[model samples]
Target: MSEKINVGDKAPDFELIKPDGSTFRLQNQLKETNVVLYFYPKDNTPGCTKQACEFRDQYEVFKEHEAEVVGISADSSDSHDEFERSHRLPFVLLSDTGNKVRNLFGVPRKFGIIPGRVTYVIDKDGIVRYIFNSMTKPLEHVKNALEVLKNIEKK
Candidate 1:
């Protein structure tokens, strides 16, 4: 794996495909708002569903703070589309094929198999403000990201 991106490091810019097949560039997004970039394992899974719903539930609050919630997974665009429509997820879900972007962010695998559950809070300037990595406590990612976005807003 590449060197893990830390709190103070600049978030690496990457391009991925959204469920609608539109391209999503990280740097381009940072120009408009802070990004809550999350990498989950799969679509329609138990833990991933809960985490996405949590973000969906608090999405307006994130928007109030000028942050955008984005989810990434190795799943295909079709799967992401279904997940979003099924749960009514308001944020964007990008398809990270081959785990390229996940590797770019250095998200580790749990026990060398499952993809890591990690959330990164990147400020408007593209600096990573916070990183929460926890495979077991998936719901905590949303809470922690909101807290970080709040702190970033205060600054």
Candidate 2:
């Protein structure tokens, strides 16, 4: 895998399919708001579910900070739909079926088996302000992202 992107790097842009079968482009989102982009291994799995739920629970906090949270995985749009419905996830869940976006972000694999879990806080100008990469501490992704966004909002 390529070296993990740094905090100040420009975020790689990608187009992904949303659970609703519509397409979402990272650049388009950046035009309006800062983005909290997270890459997870799969949908409905244990760790992934906890991470998603944490994001769902703190989604209002994210919005109040003027940031939008988006979760991505290699699952198909159909799977994302079911996962979103089951979890009542308010933010967008995108399908990166081929791991294209995952690779674009250079998210490493944990134990060389599952995709690495990483969260990125991208400012409105499309520059990444922070990256938290951890396969085990899923909920920290939400906490770290909120902290970064709160700082960004203050500046």
Candidate 3:
């Protein structure tokens, strides 16, 4: 429940362990391209699976726009690895086991058990230009954010 950010705010820097045993630093990775960072609840579950698969479906478009997609969840690295493998996801899945990263991003949730669906579109300059939060229909968020990024670049 941190309300510390709004549009045009500098995106906070973070470093988390990726499922591949590599570390991801926000500022470093996003120095060139826009970032589509989505926080989901669990892997392999129906909602989460659909959302992830949708991202996978549009991976090439995100790449075409020079944007990188990353997913964060409270699940373990092992779980993330399994999910990635099962889904053939072509992007990074970071593990935030302690929920510290989620808290840092101020992702809303319920009962602290399920993660609220939130997507942040960070521009190349590391600023949060757009944020989309939806309680349901999380799978549509990637398309929404992608459209926003496209419109922003058109400007």
Q: Give me the candidate number with maximum TM-score.
A: 1
Deviating ranges (above 4 Å) for candidate 2: 1-3
Per-residue lDDT of 1-155 in model 1, one digit per residue for the tens?
Answer: 77889999999999987877788999999999999999999999999999999999999999999999999999989999999999999999998878888998899999999999999999999999999999989899999998998888788
Positional deviation of residue 132's Cα in model 2 after best superposition, in angstroms: 0.3
Clashes of each: 0, 0, 0
lDDT of 2 by residue, 68-145 (tens): 999998888889889999999999988877888888888998888788899999999999999999988999999999
Give the Å error, residue 93, model 3.
Answer: 0.5
Model 3 C-alpha lDDT per residue in residues 51-97, reported as the tens digit of each score? 99999999999998889999999889999999999999999999888
The lowest-lDDT stretch of 10 consecutive residues in candidate 3 is 1-10
Residue 10 of model 2 has an lDDT of: 95
User: TM-scores for all candidates?
Assistant: 0.98, 0.96, 0.94
List residue ranges in candidate 1 displaced over 4 A: none
Model 2, total clashes: 0
* Residue 145 Cα positional deviation in candidate 2, in Å, after optimal superposition: 0.6
lDDT for every model?
0.93, 0.91, 0.87
Candidate 2 vs candidate 3: the TM-score winner is 2
User: What are the per-model C-alpha RMSD values against the true structure?
Assistant: 0.7, 1.0, 1.3
